[model samples]
Target: MNNLGRNLALWVSIIVMLLLLVDVFQPGNTQHAAQQLAYSDFITDVDTGRVRSVVMQNQNVSGTLTDGTAFETFAPQDPSLVSRLTGKGVEVVAKPLDQEGSPLLRYFLNALPIILMVGIWLFMMRQMQGGGGRGAMGFGKSRAKMLTEKQGRVTFEDVAGIDEAKGELQEIVDFLKDPQKFTRLGGKIPKGVLLVGPPGTGKTLLARAIAGEANVPFFTISGSDFVEMFVGVGASRVRDMFEQGKKAAPCIIFIDEIDAVGRHRGAGLGGGNDEREQTLNQMLVEMDGFESNEGVILIAATNRPDVLDPALLRPGRFDRQVVVSNPDVGGREKILRVHMRKVPLASDVDPRIIARGTPGFSGADLANLVNEAALAAARLGKRTVSMREFEDAKDKVLMGAERRSLVMNEEEKKRTAYHEAGHAITAVLVPESEPIHKATIIPRGRALGMVMRLPEGDRLSMSKKNCIAHLVVAMGGRVAEEVVYGKDNICNGAMGDIQMATRVARSMVTEWGMSDKVGMIAYANDDQGGGGMFFGGAAKNFSEHTAMEIDSEIKRLIDEAYDQARNYLHDHVDELHRLAEALLEYETLSGEDIRQIMRGQPIERVEVDETTPVNRRSSVPQVSGPEIVQPGDKPENDKDEGGEVHPVPQPG
Candidate 1:
């Protein structure tokens, strides 16, 4: 009704403006059209008896001439004008001064500017108010968007790989569906459920699934939406949001990235953000304060749960914190199948094999991988996505897209081949090292070449021997370069390899306590854990002597790996030459190709799909050698590590 009234007023004002414009611009009727005459001409005509009749109002005069022509003129102060006209046999009438023109039209003309100014001011005010409470003045309103049924519904079936999280949230669905079941036994549904995990682990997806299963209103918002630039706005928004939640009882409220507003109070060098702190305080009060919010379940998600305020995670607030970590082999296979349903796949496209190759992929990453494969098939104008397309997609995702356009000279190509051949041979011979999946002298991203190794399956832990094998594989490129081109010709291509080996060795001595000389103690600082950056800074817990011992152990570990790599390359010099030569000729070799070359058997490169070319050589030139990609055991460099690796049993 308010909108109707406003629109009606707007239309009426527009019509009125149109009428006024027409009144001002309308052409006069032919009979009433009068020629404007000068005062002197009018007087001359009156003196000559040419005037027929005159109507006078103040100093303005209009009349019809003897010839029946109408005319109007402004007369000067002539006191005898009317008497003279009567004496000259001219018919005369007088009009009052106030009757000079249409009174309403004159009054409207005087007030037009004022009226237009007022209208514009009112329009601006209405715009600022946003009519429906969504403008500058509506900052206090909550931004939570209610997800209606019209918006695509996502159920538990759509979500895969995080079954444990789904199971944990199932009770909430049950509570919303039949609250009396738990209430009859004097049990109240949990106040809130906190979904905590790394990013892209299906936390938000789980929340939506719960809402879909329960068949209730779902109000979704982000933590940053609650706090704004204005003071007291966040608190007001919190109150508004809860009021909305209360009205939509039996509904679920999902807040993504809640750490934005729920950080620990009074935590900063300068001081805590008063607005954010107040918002957090208001949220805490509403969750478990004097009044209860019945039938309203609040679900929040954050990857950084440690930074949240304790008040927000108490029993009455977010009573349960469900961890949604990355999926295992079975879960990954399920996730892949779920994503694969959207793409047409060939009979040989096995989800299990793809899952095994992708060790640390999240649900989002799996979906992306499937999409990339489908796109690759489309690029080739193929009817269906095949296993070969999936393999190329995986390589593209792990390493970058193949730079077949990057041309390389013969010498540089040979050097890159030998560098990668070093890694492939060391990984194949080392009993504890993982198997080399593929080796390519083709430039990818910033690296001239890369050797990719895949674990047999998911790796849950690493052993002492496995760490040593990783160090040796990391040093293999440098060792091969030194052996083939001599120490004097060794290039800066080993920078990445050296960094990887050093990090692994340092972790072994400092964090994993794998060093005998450094003793079985964790000398590394936990700077990233609990209260990160805000309160985690402190001096080294160990003394100078212990630090020295740790440094010495790290150096000793790397030096041993380097010597081991050199000796192994020296022993298998002939095999190294064979693999390098094959790489130079073929450009890229899969696990089977590498195995065949190492066993002194010739390989037949057969085309799986004639539509898409395989193992194309680079036509563009590159100036550098190959670099090795290492797998980091720590979370900091998890994604860069690409995939996981574990010890593979040696063949008898």
Candidate 2:
């Protein structure tokens, strides 16, 4: 389409240039050769009867001589001169020069300026009205790209994952190919298919795949396209779009992000009758209205199905809602392989390993992962993307980039080194905690130091033991800081760790039904919950004593985890010092490195007193990287608009 647009502009420019050339570059070869005789010379020739068939207009005269040579001369405007020439036996005519010869070219030249000015005026008006550009359709029209059957060659084979979604849409292709096959069984094709999925799940890609399978016309538009400031413009465009779709029967119209337009009515306090609702109403009617079965299927995609208007999802409107979810383990491997096919990868690069690392990554996310790996390799001037670059890309995606330029004093470095070492040791010591991948004092995102962990595999439901173990691991930083440097000497670098640990303890007591004192009772507002009860959901119909019991249980759980971590670190004080010294020397340590160092010293479980003394320490803030508390946990790194985490913020 872009090529077609360029070609159209080129042709228009060529035509415009040709018109200007004809007007400005006409040759005057014959005019220069014609004799330019004065009025007296012309009269003399007329009196001698040598001039024949003379024509004159406004002092411009041309005549044929007796010698058969055509000559031109200037004559004073004299009405009687023509009669005198006729009396002298010279054939004469009194007419405008253009009328006596070719007048069409003169008329065209006169009209050209007016035409050009009108064309320019119209072009300026179009530009002002935002009607695409000059010679484009009106602004009120749909901006959908009309793709032919041949244009979209991205078939189901080109796409990967979302097997269920593909299966749901495959029937639409069969219906379009031969509607009789379904109608014979009274299956009358579905009027619309709403693709519901999370962002980056390849909803739009699947729509194109359907188009490719159908081998029919495809009209691709965004939901935002159906919104306009003018009240009726949106409805007009919706009508026009449906009309076009009906005309091109056996076609697929895919509207990406349909929730933008089809949001529930009366959602905003701004008023009921708004442009978007009216447009959505019209779209609803057009979908299941009269002549709905014109061999046209509407495919709409949105990550937010819960927010869409119920009317739009009714039985006849969007008859089917296909949930396009993130790919599973095998599915993710397949998706990675599909994306890796185009890029040159080293022999050591394994898609299965990458798929295993990325548990909840959507198809689009996996594609970006592959692309990022390739770009990383290219930036390093490598011929092929190796597993090393892929690993770096994955880390860069999950955690922010390493802030190598961040300078830290010896004391602060020592604190950060110990903080990360505490986390690494706790993770290895905790019974059900995930294995630590790497530990580093290298600043990443808002973190001063971090201990990264990779889950053994995907876990849907985390056991109570694992959740509590995570709580102990999260509190390890604060516990180690308090034991090594006194309690007051523990800076707020362990702030993220504290918050994660507290949340898990609170969840275990309030929602997970694991607390002995609050046994089998949920104090949370909603299921799987971490929300205040005041806003909405189930009423907290419990007594004040029950609430106090919940709070006490939460505090008791956190204190227990804290005590466990403190005891573990106190017992392995020498090993913890060794790990921290390693971090201080190398600025980083792998899981294997921590394991190797601890292998020399056997771990001894120890119990410690809860009361610890606080020693005065500087209040300088040190940011640290987030760690996954469990298999399905996400880090606290802030994501930018492009979904990538920004650079590690400067430590305060």
Candidate 3:
């Protein structure tokens, strides 16, 4: 029922109950007095001898004659006058009792029901408001949800994009399913498996899938949930959580964002007494305290493994650490297909193509892309999601949602068009760079324009030439602005691009053995000391003079690459102008359109200089300076270092 109708019904029921209670408790004598007052005048007119039966109006009064002289003059005592007859001629005698109780006692006894109803209402209100220590006392109860195998919906089939991680975790499921198999082989099962990766990589999802596959109970909670304002609450929760998990043995405890409570103690300004530290200490103790016989396994996920405590990561605690990273092309395709199952997709909508377009997308990103595509189709009142919708959805996901209402002046639009076109042309022409996916003059997120490129596949090792090409592509937009609109038109739009290029250049010189002067040495900093502090040894591969020479060489390389791009665009100015104009008109253009304008055909093959060896490619002939190094030979400084130079390994 509606609220008003329910309230009215409650009011009516209460009123009826009150009236019935009043009737049951009302004094009978008081009502009898009311009736006698209506017949007072009639009884006074009755003669003594003829009044054998006296009728006073509609009520009958019967009495036995106590004296015979009452025939001459008869006077009935007034019900209100009975108390005033105390000092009169006759003495009144007591009458025998006919009923058992007084009316006053019955009235109070019947009011008991109303008192009970009031007591119940007060109790319920106190509980709901968390008053009277009713609901408030339950605050320390565990928030971890216990999910049985029948209740779990996620299995191995539901998760994608991390096959290696899955394989590692699958062993844990096997151990949980059949512990004796490992014991017979003299193998001890790992107590805990830490899933470490960036956010949105499906770490928590994998844990759930493991529980579902093993058909075991799953207890899921966040790391922060164990902490509370009280000092000892966190420790208490950790104890209780483990105690519960032990009872439900052969279960998995999935803690997401474990970094919240598992950070290194005393690392923060907040001392060891901090609640989070207390919680972490308790967790360490609990994890270590358990015997190998206990089947309860702990699964924790975190994006920041570096910040975790060393004690917690020692062998018996977190025995295995699985890194779940962004999906590769094949993995991305699998993730996309898994997400696309719920979407009403057209026949032409290919998950492989979508996956190829997104190089760094996580599993969450793929799911969001599919959801966005479905939303786009629904907005247009379409039955199925098409390729165009998916493309738009991808743009929306990577960038921000479309801002059609974000109007810009004509000059700004032109600048954005040229900027995007510059990136596209440069990336397309550069041999070591990936192919351009899309270039848009439309404002997306904080960018005035954007250019997107998809890597051919995941790269584990990047060559020096490939690194330089990437830097050149990054600087293309600024170079285009300088070449076309002069240096005066350069803006802050290239800040991210500049930072990226600088990092790549630094990596080349220090780590990749790309520089001739700073040959076969690494000066890269490991920023895990505290708050990303850089700490490392210096590069002894070069002298002060050689350092200056290296700096000059890097600048000259960037300057030459910029000039090459500018000259190429200058020779094909008409094509550049056409592409820019098309971008301004359409707001977005594909790589094929830009390719057609440049070469009048699609790209056949991206050239790779195989004639030059990988180590010698950086020493190619240039405008000035002596050749620094030869192929398969260390520099003179290598002997100074007391050994032959070998290439430093690249960062993983």
Decoy 1 TM-score against native: 0.78
Please, what is the TM-score per model? 0.78, 0.72, 0.66
lDDT of each: 0.78, 0.74, 0.67
**Top-TM-score structure, candidate number:** 1
Q: Rank the candidates by TM-score, best first.
A: 1, 2, 3
lDDT by residue (1-652, candidate 3, tens digit) is: 4545766787678767776767856675343222222233423323232222221221233332333212222235556432332223232343443567886576556766775786687576555433424233334555678877564389999998799999999898898899898999899888899999988989988999999888888999998787766677678778878877988998998898998889878877645459888888888888887454288799999999988999999999999999999887788879987887766666556676676666567888888888888898889897777666777887777666656677888987787777667777777778876666666776666667777665555555667666666666766777767777899867766666665655557777766778887677664443333333322353243456755766676676666667777766666667677787887776765666567657655323222232332231132122111211111111011010001111222344
Can you give the lDDT of residue 63 in candidate 2?
82
Model 3 misses residue 469 by how many Å? Answer: 2.1
Candidate 3 residue runs with Cα over 4 Å from true position: 1-141, 149-152, 268-275, 290-293, 409-411, 482-503, 506-513, 517-554, 601-652
What RMSD value applies to candidate 3?
Answer: 14.3
Candidate 1 lDDT over residue span 1-652, tens digit each: 7646776787688668756764665445225668999988988899999999999988889999999999999988989988889988999989988636886786577667757876787667646433434633466788889997656789999888888888888989999999999999999999999999888889998898888889999999999888766678789988999999999998999999999999999887663499899999999999999999999999999999999999888898999999999888778879998887767766556676677767678888888899999999999998888777887887777667877897878888888889888888888888987667677777766678877776555666778888899889878888998899999998877776777777788888887878888777877675556332322346466766777888899999999999999999999999999999998888888777788888999977654443343222222111111111222221222111112122221211
- Clashing residue pairs, candidate 3? none
Per-residue lDDT for 49-141 in model 2, tens only? 888778777678888899887888887668798678879887767775454546567646755776687678778767654564424345566
Better of 1 and 2 by TM-score: 1
Model 2 misplaced stretches (Cα beyond 4 Å): 1-130, 133-140, 149-152, 268-273, 516-550, 601-652
